[model samples]
Target: MKKEIAAVVFFLKRLIKKAEKLEAEKVDLFVERLTVALQEKFRGHWYTDNPSKGQAFRCIRVNRFHKEDAELLRACVESGVQYTDLGLPKELTLWVDPGQVCCRYGERNLAFTVASFSSDDSDDKEDVTKKVTSAVERVTSDYHSGSSSDEDNGCREPRYITGFSHRPPYQQSLLCHRMAGHVPVFCGDRGDSRRHVVLAQ
Candidate 1:
């Protein structure tokens, strides 16, 4: 009876050690993939935030599109890892700062700083996953439709983006045309100027 109990304890210890090892490897792989995505797609930097905090690895910051989701999501997918694994919150909310996007995973929550939008309540995993999927689909569609192969291969000109979401259809169409590199002459100005647009990706 004593020998059997000792053997059981030893086996359990070995299994626990194996599980820890696997978890460590998974964390390492996640970090590596994230780093690559930041460097290649966003031309950004990735580094550890602090070693003392639990699962607090790194946050991404880019010079351009720091407040935009399209480039960030593209980088996430290009990393070839799941968003959850990358420590994205189930109820993802982006808080904005000047010229930088930030995120960190904690034991209790996932924090992101990118835009003004936010949510206190966490959503179900399935719901969050679906939202991310749909958003990625939209981004992919926009990428393929807006830019051609030549433009994609060549040096991308800086884009002037206006807050066209609230604008009327004609204005939105005009901006879209501009986005596609067609400089259509507008004979009359309705009090809108180039100062209103922000230079972005």
Candidate 2:
């Protein structure tokens, strides 16, 4: 019984020593990784598409207007409008219209006279034109591409060729611009439903 106890004690000492060493190594690794992360953050070179990079593509802004306000605008703009929750700040929803004129980015801004609009007419061609034009302008400006055409079929073509284009730079610029108040399509996941949730968190 004495020998058995001695043996057990000896084995336990060795195990504890190994565990301590492992703990020390883990701490060292953590410190090293944290240092690298801090440097990257300060340098603004930390973004990556890697699932582990921890980024998001959504921009949410809170407006003073409430849902009722939005609804009022909807009624004035068009009937049969659709509004959906954006999971954003207190009072905003996505608005859509079927008959609205969709403006492409970088298109010429159009001016409309209020005299052309009547209370009975629900078509807000002027508002649609402005919203689309603004969205397109913001996208183009962030991407640094040339002006978009106003031709009937004018569409902003992707500047980069597939398989050879370096997309990180362009994507980063767009991301930053979106963060800086550009109204862009929210494409980021809200840290759920995928292994890549880190990118949106």
- Clash pairs detected, candidate 1: 94-115, 95-114, 95-115, 96-114, 96-115
**lDDT accuracy of residue 76 in candidate 1:** 42
Go through the candidates in order and give each one's C-alpha lDDT: 0.35, 0.29
Write down the lDDT that model 1 would get: 0.35
Q: Pick the candidate with the highest TM-score.
A: 1
Per-candidate TM-score against the hidden true structure: 0.26, 0.17
lDDT of 2: 0.29
Q: Candidate 1: misplaced stretches above 4 Å?
A: 1-118, 139-180, 187-201
Model 2: lowest-lDDT 10 consecutive positions: 94-103
lDDT of 1 by residue, 1-201 (tens): 112112222222222233343354444454444344434542222222422232222232221223333434554466454443333222222222222233322211344322221233343545434443444343234333444222334544554444455776677666555533335333233477532343233
Assess the local accuracy of residue 195 in candidate 2 as a C-alpha lDDT between 0 and 100: 16
What TM-score does model 1 achieve against the real structure?
0.26
**Candidate 2 segments whose C-alpha is farther than 4 A from its true place:** 1-121, 145-196, 199-201
